[model samples]
Target: MARIQTEHGGRNVQVDEYKGKKIEVATGYDARSDRWPVHVYIDGQKVSGQASADNMSEAFDYGFALAQREIEQQ
Candidate 1:
């Protein structure tokens, strides 16, 4: 597992191998409302969107799934 720090978002982001590709999961608070959002990036492309949630774990799960599904289609 690896971690990345993004100035805009993704608090303590985690990187891992998934389905023969490198998947990244990140969490950070939105500029407004202080809501934590999870974002997923694959191969430098943002496959998943920002998902706001109270817990980082749930958000990451959703974001990761979203990214994987999108990648499968392409």
Candidate 2:
């Protein structure tokens, strides 16, 4: 079973575990770009892709979903 853990700050972070592997979603505001940048990690390895959203909440959702898909496909 997996559960989500979230923390809020300058960088919003969410963490989960799937099949004993750790998945992390991090979102941060990019002032220069006026976008929220999202980063997804699985078991400490960063997934390669350009992910961004217009808002912090959306960024977190996108990141979490992306991470789940990556985990499922593996």
Candidate 3:
């Protein structure tokens, strides 16, 4: 597993990839509310695009869980 970090506003957020399976983790901002957003993807497919958690760990976990659920469903 490799840990990837995406930086925004000079703050780096760590996102873990499972065996480098093309999982991408990125952050965005909600312009309307000025809130930070965390987005996760798998194989270039979006797993979750939501705003949650103040820390990277929880945000990444949410994305990872989403990926797991998607895999189980398929």
Q: Give candidate 1 regions above 4 Å deviation.
A: 1-10
Off by over 4 Å in 3: 6-21, 28-35
Clashes of 1: 1
lDDT by residue for model 1 over 1-74, one digit each (tens)? 23343333446576765667777877776668677777778877776344677766676667667777876877
RMSD each, Å = 3.8, 2.0, 3.6
> Residue-wise lDDT of candidate 3 within 1-42, one digit each (tens)?
465676755343455556445666665444665544667667
Winner on TM-score between 1 and 3 is 1
lDDT by residue (23-60, candidate 2, tens digit) is: 88888889999999999999999999998999987987
Give the TM-score of each candidate.
0.67, 0.83, 0.53
Best by TM-score: 2
Q: Number of clashing residue pairs in every model? A: 1, 0, 0
A best-first ranking of the candidates according to their TM-score comes to 2, 1, 3
The residue pairs that clash in candidate 2, if any, are none
Query: Judged by lDDT against the true structure, how good is candidate 3?
Result: 0.60
